[model samples]
Target: MIAFFLQGLAIGIVSLIPGVSGMTVAVALGIYRRLIDSTKNFTKHWQSSLDFLLPFWAGVAIGIGLAVRLVAYGLTTFPFPTAMLFIGLLAGSIPLLLKQYWLATVGRKQLDRPLQLLILVISFCVALILALIQLNSPLSGLSMTFPTLWALFSLGVLSSVAFLIPGFSGSLLIMLLGFYALLTTRLMGFMHDILTNSLYIDWNSFFFVITFISGFIIGFIIFSHFVMAVVINYGQLTFASAFGVLLAAPLAIIVCTKALANLQGSISVVLVMSALLFLVVGFMTTYVLGLYSTEFTREHPHQGS
Candidate 1:
């Protein structure tokens, strides 16, 4: 129970970062398939699975509850530094994912080395080019308004779709919608007023939350089930493409983050260091949690060969 909650909370926090994905973090924590299986078979493993998932879901809710403000403030006051930190973390974690996927193919004598190398080279080059471009990526500079409720709902739906997809990042979708900052601000505003006055939740804010949650729930459940089915049916080719997209994402974030002009300052070094620290933390957390474990063959009983 405790482990699941902690893991979910950690994943939830990671999901707030632009380039990071809760799905990846869940995979890193060794719970990706388990969660899906449990969700699908909610009848059989209700006791144990719910014990693990409920707290994790609660943690996700809480982390988002808190992050709604902190991320907003960070972006508002120190956008570039914050973005740089996230980019660094994203860059550091790529190798870990690569290592995991590589190990998954161990014992497969039929696996083509050339094809694997080709995929890696192509992914690396594409990521490099994307990194260079994002450094100067233009901003929309758009703000959210009450009249834009439909737009916000739509953005939430899109983000939810990404969240459900294996290699996609909900935060990246938020960035694409240009409301990355706007929604963060509104979330903070909602939080501030909530604490200032008892029983005074903003109806508008509440509606957004309800709508976003609705979209996220509907999208995540349906898409995850479908994707899981596909993976079960076609594991290798599907994984290769998924891995390619995953590799491409952090590169995109790194590029776009550095492109922001405000990234230079005295605190930049410290921030970068902090980001590196978290990057290491992310790697260690994923590694130590048995997320990248290559010894599950006996238990899962798959023919890597």
Candidate 2:
């Protein structure tokens, strides 16, 4: 339970990065299949599913809550070094991905490696273009109306579809729909407002949350079974595309963050050394976690839990 909670925490924190995939993070932690299984059986086996999922969801909530404040501060205060740290963390997952997929891919000599290469290149370009476009997209302002409500529902539906595929950035898709900016502002705004003594809540914001989540839950359950079918039917190609997106995502992070641009000409030795140090720290952290997760999943599979 503690391990599941920690895995959720890490997923939530890293997932805050633009263009990063929460599903990829879950896969790296060795819990993606268990999560899908839990969700699949939740209706029929509510008790056992709750035992496995409760702590995990709690960690996700807290992780995102803390990351919201901390990332905002770090990005504003120590932009480049902070960005470097996250980039390193994102890059660190590549080794784990390679270890998991590359050998299997190579073993299947009949599979079209050339086609996979094409997918890798194409997906990389697609992710890069989306990130660049989103960096320029207007992200703030929302009004509660019929159209807005419909839009939120549509976003929820699309998010459910995007989230199942590793390396597909559901947040990036949300941004493309023109709601990402206002959605984030409202979330953080509500947090600030709720923290005040009055505990006042805005009905409009509350309604939006309920509507979006409603659509998400509906879509999630309906699509969960189908997604695994797609993955199994098109395993190598699917993962190849996923790897491409994963590779391009770090570059997207750099562009979206403008971390280097935030330096203000203070490119000192201290900054360089500090950036490198943090990068190594992020790398080692994921490397170790990914390493242990492999062994842990084999010895203590989540099925019995």
Per-model TM-score on C-alpha atoms:
0.71, 0.82
Each model's lDDT: 0.61, 0.69
* lDDT per residue as tens, model 2, 152-199: 887888887777766566665665455554555566666666677446
Task: Give the residue spans of candidate 2 off by over 4 A.
Answer: 103-109, 169-182, 203-212, 295-305
Candidate 2 structure, TM-score to reference: 0.82
> lDDT for model 1, on a 0 to 1 scale?
0.61
Q: Name the runs in model 1 displaced over 4 angstroms.
A: 43-48, 103-158, 164-166, 198-201, 235-251, 254-259, 263-305
Evaluated with lDDT, which candidate comes out highest?
2
lDDT of 2: 0.69
RMSD of each: 4.7, 4.1
Question: Candidate 1, residue 86: CA error in Å?
Answer: 1.4
- lDDT score, candidate 1, position 281: 67
Cα lDDT of model 1 by residue, 19-82, tens digit? 6657766666667777777776667878876877789898887788777666666666655556
